[model samples]
Target: MSTSLGRGLACSALAIAAASTAPAEVPRVATDIAPVHGLAARVMDGLGTPDLVVTPGASPHEYAMRPSEARALQEADAVFWIGAELEPWLEESIGALATDARVVELLDVEGITTLEFREGATFEGHDHEHGDDAGHDHDHDAGDHPGHEDEAEGDHAHAEDDHADGDHGSDHAEGAAHVESQGDGAHADHAVDEDHDHAGHSHEGIDPHAWLDPGNAGIWLDVIAEELSALDPENAQTYRDNAAAGREEIAAAVADVEETLSAAGGVGFVVFHDAYHYFENRFGISAAGAISLSDASDPSPARIEEVQETIRDLGVACIYSEPQFSQSLVATVSDGTEARAAVIDPLGFELETGPGFYPALIRSIGESIAGCASS
Candidate 1:
């Protein structure tokens, strides 16, 4: 409902117009992440150029703004960040910037359904292990808390219990068979517990990687168009026009991706990280599991074992890594699972030019998934 554009934003647009016609003070726009940068690039077509400071191949997990990036943010006519929670690193820098700069938090904008982190999910298992056991208390005394346990039991009955099935089968299996099956499921459960431990901690719960979903790209485009129109009323039509065109192209790319992925046979694959949930959600492609949760943290032996078990259990069709991350981790995970390692650029780690880059990026992921499937 906060419809007012930030202060000096329209003035900056005037400056851009004036700069083109007379002077040369085009409004500088800074985007926090790659998807925003891509959408903004489309909105900025034929208008003034916007400065995208975060280069391709950089992960938002730990993007420290460099001197050059800081300078770009400080000098921008409009500043765009996903949200405070998603990009904590950018917060202090954004707060330090001049008030006159139009600080637009895109997630806060109307009509955007921000992805909520899976309610009780955490990045701790993927990032690092911690002893903060206060948040995720998974224990309850069956005697003292009979009522709560009964409720939990009811809930378990309503929702299919995967563990219960495994446990039931384990009861009848012989020694080695029981041990092997139980061990595999136990390893998977431990990994799940590790992930669950950081439930309440606020560090971007739902995957902030919405750009991976091409349908979500349409949502971002609408926001960009509205923001650009507000900033430059005179040339608003151009911004809207470009955004519409961009969306159509992205939709086509999305269609191609779906077709390719559908034909790829199984949705099973492995990724360097769990950042591709939106992609999976969009195309129904199931990454067997992530090699590691964070690019910042190397996978522990136990964690690697869980990933390997998932690959084996799911009959993973391929293993894909990102150009943004080092190939070593992917190679190791692939080697352990005997899955082929292929590089997929989610953040456009490589330079992509022209207006069609958005579609090209989407199609590239589809191609990568399909190619790895056939191989």
Candidate 2:
């Protein structure tokens, strides 16, 4: 070959080798809630931290996007949210704002176990058919209460129905195919149903509090790792390794919380709103009832009367308020009653925002409940 031809071949070979070893492009990711962002942060540990759309102290139920947040979404290569059921406002905006981004609704991701909103109910036992199937035997017998077994069974069945209606199979392809076969309106209508009403609050369908269950969080770690790895193929193993480590940590934290709350297992408590069902159920703690359905609204007089009656009738031990809402309602309900009042931060608003936030959030919940119930 001539000198010029040999030089051209050498340059081409160098280009090919460089292209072969180049690292995958890291996608800019945006996440909806703090806890969800916490999980994504773990998966993206060495890659990059995902931007959080909703800030601390803001309720996802009624968050309006700021201009900067909108810009973040527009710039994101991938957007991870729970689903329309959790943030209905995002239903239209995500498609319009983050049109170029790959939208992964963690709640719709296959292998994520979900729970339905318990209508007019408080935290019960961990008997619901979601999350890890490790059977927990509770000494707090609901059988002694009249009609408790029937009511509990009915609630469990409702939760199962909600899960089935969503058609969340273990196989991602099958689940996506099933969703597609249902037609476009199917998903929207299903979300409408799930977001429509809760406790006494007007909102969308099933309880979107799946993250409160550490088992669900463990599953989320895998899903997040898979999605991040797909986006950045060069860091696939790193993502998986982080997920494995994170999952082990979550499992350990969950076990520790369970053990700590075991002493308060049978103690009945009430909350400011109906958000902790997942946490309470996960640890086998039973709440008497909630003061209101949504933190954004005040309890109706009749509802207040009903909760007061529940507290009086059930002899509830504690009434817990959340950091995001007013404590006056909790005090009102607990006034003249023997119940002690305490606060629980379900969203980790008071904790530092990051990977540690999620585990701390769970630990805080367990400790608060145990403290109030044991007192």
Candidate 3:
């Protein structure tokens, strides 16, 4: 070949090699909760870290989007959240703020099993939909405690303002009615009204804490991998491989948790809120009840008495508090009883934030329950 022709061939060959080895473009991701972020982070391992909107120790129910977080959502290539029910505050804002971002509501995703909110369970009676009721009074000073910065201290004041004028009440009632209609027709009307009277409450419907279940997390791992791979097909195999490996790690962690809990035996306990039904149901452990129905509202004196009575009646082993909220209520209830008070960070607030956080969070919960129950 002539010199110019050979030079052209050499340049083309070099270009082809460079193109083949080039790294895939990583997408900017935003997750609503820490646990979900942890799952997505695992799928995005070796790619990029997903930004977390709700910071550590913050309750999703009452979390306000900071300007930085709002920008993160707006700039994200994809935004992942549990659903409108879990973070009703984010329902309207996400549309406006992250208009161009692909919003993935994980609860709506397939292959994942969901648990319903149990009646009379911990934090079961309070309505999350009606905003904060002035009559319901439970002291929330625990949020101001050191190291618990993001607890829902002033959430009630802004709860009503969080949504558009027409977004909450009627829509919530309609959704609740839909849920009731799905049930047997006999109690549909009563159940619908009772359940959806408050737009944000989820007392009689699907529990949003699905990530508490390791099996559910495993399912989510696949979904996250699929979504990420779709966004960046060049690294599709890497995403799938990471998900597979993450699934194994989660499975092993879950197995270890199960064994530990088994050795500790079943311990009937009480949680600060009703967030752990998924975890409890998944592990076959039972919670006697919750301190409040929603973290933003305090349990009434009557409600506290009722829960204390349950603890006494059931001989519950432990009363578990969350890191995001004050343990005062747990302390008060356990004062006259033999039940031990313990802490469990459902959102992985106490653990390092990342892909490993989910498994660590799950393991910590099991360990806490086992410790309190066994002791």
Candidate 4:
């Protein structure tokens, strides 16, 4: 070979080696549940995948983290969770395993709307379409709490100001932002005072299932993208674009759901629990009753009777059960009754974890409720 050609070949080899090291390391993200994992995954699309701590079919209220889950946290560069109100079981694990990770308490994320848990055995006169003048009473300021969905009747707390503008990098700790209520909403003890139990931890506050509201999902996608971008700035544009695209997808999903439920204003239904309140509120529908409380404890005989009565009096078309919980309760309530029974998987237990999963989850919920209403 000629001397010049040999020198050029050596230079090309050195350039190739330098180019390989130019890309930044992808972040290791961890999430508390599948829904949140789906959101994080969207933000990190084409970058890396986030670890889901509590897999589908595993109750976040009572999950025993596997060794693999713990290891994921230990290796995580960042963590996303809805706060103790939803998954108190993961608190200690995160504290111990993901100490260095930037923890995002989504419940504390500002500008996100929230609602107080309804009180009572049955929603009865609390129908969203015909809701009486009865409103809500909340303690501990929720930064951006809106009044009764679109109306100005109810006064619930919403956490804002402290969590917006990409400011969710700090570790979530005590007094982060807790909600206390007198349970004086239109509906039982939905919002007990400052002390409640979820996996034997303090959980007196918001519904924690904010993901049900496609509006909140949009808010969360931006926050997820911001948090991921902060860690992986090299792909910041990709993260931002992914977040925007995710929001657009959610927007389309919301519009489709809104159209499906447009005429469903007064359609009454019973849920397995109160987890769907966010979804109900988003689409302007309300549950006639929930067979069990938000805690998923066995309902008292009186509560069951109340729910059954609600089903009968309102001519509730369908009773929805969740895949993660017992179907017997829904069956028991609707037995010998005309109400058709159905299932709505809140965590998208049947979904593949990815960018498309979040919108699909919301769409499934809308379809279930709308389908039941028409049935």
Candidate 5:
């Protein structure tokens, strides 16, 4: 085990020791991602700490558990994560489990409604879906919520196209051959292509990365509290109290960002990716459009043209790029728009340090936009 994993385990051990006098070994709680780690840390404050699968600065999309992390998962009394969909790689490991790992997925447990990757909602999407999935309020259906279904349909179509165009075809040649032999391969391919065009071209909605919304952060904290209490009934009060405090802190931080941004008269910015719907919705700011769709994918000429047009039309003041994304992409996009470029660290991609890290994250975003707006 690396020293970090060893320290995490040791911390868990110490947390367990400080809380319990029972002969039974302390429950080892393990978390799958950094955001989950943020919630778990609060829930476990003064109780036993949980093990985090992804380190502080790793990308969640490509995370692979180390042996020590797997061991932590194996020994864990419970495991918490954002969701299987968000972390597709963890599905096999989690699904093939032998023991009762007591997984508390915040996307499921927190009762927050989920949205697809890209949505057809707004210039900067709203936060209605990201909070309080307490009822059967699933507006994910196509006509049910105006543009939502179309956006989802668009994503579905894009996925179908990617599959048909052999983006992943070489890896699944046998499947491709079977489809081709069945005479449905070409038909399937056509259907997928049509869907992709519709979705990608419609471009009528906000990107649904709701976890970026701090208001939804409240839901996650609530879910974490419930799970911690269930796991350690003895310290349920402590867990609940700690979670309440964390919730208040995060909420206050979000409010501060809102106040700051409101005072700045709603800054107009551009982003490398359309991951700002949740953030923009809360502060009533704007990100003209993304420089790209998938962070790893390159933008086509037409897409770049659209960004240039949006920048001109919206009077975009700054183009904000994330840490892992190409700064060059932002620079290229900004060249046509005549917009200045700013860098924002999303924290899931960086080693965030301090209890005020989440707060600092939100403030940093506000400050970046505010700076551009003022300039």
Candidate 6:
């Protein structure tokens, strides 16, 4: 009887040892854009790679999902997105696919800060208020907000349709086959209805570009680790450890960017077709005025001349430009002034994608502004 009992205890010990050495399971994760992917990738660094939905060089505002992207959503255990405000197009598809996946809307992640869109070519007032959910309030509570049903609709609650991205129905029509498969009255069908309405909607709500802020990036890392942990408890500790490392990495980058931009001294004004205030606000710099008018629109010839005059008067260190607007016009505005036209991309379109991408993107913005301002 003593030997039998001893044998049983020995078998139990071996079983326990085997379980301890088994490989940990990680969730199959999917993320919306490069920055979000980079953050999520940090948490799942050794466990697995999170799939990115919005590939680089592609416009999130008016993107059409490919078949592989749809497959990634359908098979994913979790999906991370910036929320409807940034990729208003992906809403419906997420709802239709990614059915069982846990979707983490980073914008709605508790403690994440949001900024409202700055209107006009020249953001006149240059308001720096952080709204609950940017300028456009979305319930993401789907159904009634047929307006928010334009894009992907996987696992997100979706809320009210953000009229902010009015409609880019045409851009999705030619190649959105995967999206077109989402049943009879899917959002893709509605998008086709707004073929020419892209210019019709005024994008006044929240600026969904929250990832630009390294502080926000750090906040996102913790939440990402938490959610991924819940889905894959076996790797919870690894996820947490990765997040801690990511936060430290982000802190280090923020300090470096601060050091670089400490002397920028404001280039008098910033002309942004899209918004860069998240970066500006993070670094304690602000644009005095915009190159547009009261609303966020292209300036009339008179408005352009007025901006040029201001550039001349201030001898603005540099006049910034984005691809959304005309380069020729920017050159004309800087023609007689000492202000040099410098391009600053908010999307980090040129940066490599990976765990290090977010920090690199943040530093690049600081370098661009500081370099241009000083030169």
RMSD of each: 19.6, 12.3, 14.5, 9.8, 13.3, 9.9
Q: Please provide, for model 6 over 279-323, each residue's C-alpha lDDT reduced to its tens digit, 9 standing for 90 to 100.
A: 776777776445543112455677677677666666666777765
- List, residue by residue over 1-375, the lDDT tens digit for candidate 5: 899999999999999987786633446777765555666666666555567665555544445444445555556677767665455556556554315666755554323444445542114443334333423233223221111111110000000000111122222223221112222211211112212432122232323344566655555565556665666677777766766677677767777777777777855677776666666655656565677654434667677777777788878778888875557777777786668887775544443532334555667777777777777
State the number of backbone clashes in model 1: 4
Better of 2 and 6 by TM-score: 2
How do the residues 1-375 of candidate 1 rate in per-residue lDDT, one tens digit apiece?
233665467778998988888633335677776556767777667666555545556555445444445556656667766665555556666666524576766544433333434321112223321112212222323332111111110000000001111112322223211122222221111122334322122424445665666655665565556666666667777867776777777767777777887787775677776667666656655555677654445566777777777776666767788775568766666665657778777666563643555677777778888898888
Candidate 4 lDDT, tens digit per residue, 1-375? 999999999999999999997889988888887788888878787777778776566667765554455666767889988888777656776876688888888777655666666777676565442122213222323322211122221111111111111222323322221211222121111322223454454324456777777766676777777777778788989987877777777778888888888755557788887788778777777788887776436777788888888788888888889876667778789886789988887888777667678888888888888887776
lDDT of 1 at 251: 68
Best by TM-score: 4
Q: Write the per-residue lDDT of candidate 3 for residues 1-375, one digit (tens) a residue.
A: 999999999999999999999987898788888888887888788777888777667667645554446656667778888887787767776776667777778676544556657676443343332112212122323321112222211100000001112222222222221122222221111112222323465565777877776766776666667677777889988877777777777877778788999999877788887788777766767778888776656676777888998888888888889876777878888878889888987777778776677778878889988888778
Comparison by TM-score, 3 against 4, better one: 4
Q: Which scores higher on TM-score, 4 or 6?
A: 4
Which ranges in model 5 have alpha carbons more than 4 Å from their true place? Answer: 1-26, 116-208, 348-355
For candidate 4, the lDDT comes to 0.68
Worst 10 residues of 1 by lDDT: 153-162
Error at 249, model 2, angstroms: 0.5
Most lDDT-accurate candidate = 4
TM-score of each: 0.69, 0.75, 0.75, 0.78, 0.69, 0.73
Candidate 2, 1-375: lDDT as tens digits = 999999999999999999998888777778888888888777777667778777667777655555445555667788878877777766666766677787777666444456666666344443565542322222223222111121111010000000102222222222221123223221211112222453223444557777787766776676667667667778988987877777766766777787888766667788887787777667766667778766555667677778888888889888888876667778788877888888987777787766666777787889898888777
Clashing pairs in 1: 19-23, 117-205, 117-206, 269-288
Model 6 bad stretches (over 4 Å): 1-21, 130-202, 288-310, 323-326
What are the Cα lDDT values of the candidates?
Answer: 0.56, 0.65, 0.67, 0.68, 0.55, 0.64
